[model samples]
Target: MQNIWSIFKRELRAYFDSPIAYVVITVFLLFTGWYFTTYFFLAGQADLRVILGIIPFAFLIITPAITMRLISEERKTGTMELLVTMPIHDSSIIVGKYLAAVALLIAMILPTLVYGITVAFLGDMDYGPAIGGYLGFLFIGAAYLAIGTLGSSLTENQVVAFIISLLIMAAFYLMDKILIFIPNSMVSIVEYLAIVYHFQNISRGVIDTRDLVYYLTLISLALFLATRAMAARRKR
Candidate 1:
């Protein structure tokens, strides 16, 4: 626990000490804010649906960039060996790094709350879906960060990590969209595997156990893979 906290603080501090956090947050806000404001006025809707709709797509870009250097940079700089040789467990290292990324994800999402507040002031806001959208975004973002961490653990180059993470995330993000091409027998399985399907379900303000399970399962599996990757490097 102590080791994890130390690593978490180190990683989080590293983000703020450099321009990475600032640049990523600025880019994310600009992308989501532009779409949300544009659609909110054009549709004359007082709801936050526009922002909710844009966030997941924005994450496809933002998450990879944020996580690209987590473990990959450590390896590239030859610090991964030093980290693994320490008394701390690999899982602790992964969890600490994962939490730092999650913190940044939260930071990126926090400013967007202003969009909801603005919509509320304009007209009656459906708090149920608004609340659900934020909650769902957190879940989806955590899952993507975990996947990105796993990708980072696989390569020494940050660019390769970014592309690897992006491709895997894109596949999951596009799964439900491609159901028409899938046979009827496999459609259910494919849709069930789609990350956005569960996210959309949660965004409707209904929190189903199945959706919770899906997200938890994805996060756990990805982190477990990252831990294994770290373990493999330790063995090597």
Candidate 2:
């Protein structure tokens, strides 16, 4: 636990100590703010549906950027070997780094609460869906971070890690959308695999056990793969 905490602080500090966190957060807020303001004014809707709808798209880009360097940079700089030789467990290192990425994700999301608050002042706002939307965002973002960590663990090149994570995420994001091309027999399975499908289910103010299970399963699977990758590196 102590080792995990230490690594978590180190990883989180690594993010803010450089310009990466600032640049990523600024770009993310700017993108989401622009869309939220435009949609709120034009649609005059009291709901956060527009912001919620656009965030997954934003995450596809921003998440990879946030996690691209977590392990890959360590490998590139030859620090990964040193770290693995320490008494610390690989799972601890992975969880700590994963938590740091999640922290950044939450930071990116916190500012968007202003949108909901603004809507409340402008008119009647339903807090239920708003709460659900944010919760759904956290779940989806955590899952993506885990997947990104797995990508980072696979290669020493940050660009390659970014591309790998982005491609995998894009495939999952497009899964439900491409159901028409899938056979009827496989439609249910494909839709179930779609990240957006589970996200949508939670964003509707209805948190189903199935959606929760799906996200937990994805996060666990990705992190497990990342740990395995780390173990393989340690062996070589």
Candidate 3:
């Protein structure tokens, strides 16, 4: 436990001291801020409906960038070799790095609270929906980050990692719509497989156990794959 925490701190500090964290956070906040303010002023949407709709698109762009260098850069510069030799457990290292990425995401999300604040003062606002939406957003981010981590583990090139992760996300996001033209019976199964389908239900201010389970399952499965990838590298 302590070992995981130690590694987590090291990786988290690396993100903060390095420039990527700042760049990702600033860009994310800027885009989200723009969307929120624009919706409030121009579109006359007092709710954060616009921002919620924009999150998936924003994450498709940023999540890959965040995970692109997670493992690839470490291997590229020989740091992965050093990291693998540490006294900590294998799971600790993977969890540590993964948590660091999650932390950065949560931090970026922190600033978007201003949108909720703004909405609160404008009209009758239901906090339940807002909180549910944020929960859904966080889970979706976690699941995508897990996929990105697995994608990064599969390659030592950041560009390849980014492309692979983004491609996977795009496929998941479009899975629902792509199933529309399929046989009606098949669409139901396909929609269940689609990430956005579950996400949409949770995002609409309703917390469904199935949606929560879906995101958790995706996160767990991807992390398991990433762990296997790390073990294979260590064996090699």
- Candidate 2 residue 125 Cα shift, in angstroms, is 1.0
lDDT of each structure? 0.93, 0.93, 0.86
**Model 3 ranges with Cα > 4 A deviation:** none
Off by over 4 Å in 2: none
Ranking by lDDT: 2, 1, 3
Per-residue lDDT for 22-108 in model 2, tens only? 999999999999898787777767668888899999999999999999999999999987898899999999999999999999988
Q: What is the C-alpha lDDT profile of model 1 across 1-236, one tens digit per residue?
A: 99999999999999999999999999999998888777777877776887787788999999999999999999999999899889999999999999999999999899998988998899788988898999999999999999999999999899999999999999999999999999999999999999999989889999999999999999999999999987887576
Candidate 2, after superposition: displacement of residue 171 in Å? Answer: 1.0
Residue 172 in candidate 1, Cα distance off native in Å: 0.4
Q: How far is candidate 3 from the true structure (C-alpha RMSD, Å)?
A: 1.3
Clashing pairs in 2: none
Quote each prediction's TM-score: 0.97, 0.97, 0.95
Quote the lDDT for 115 in model 3.
Answer: 89
- Evaluate model 1: give its TM-score: 0.97
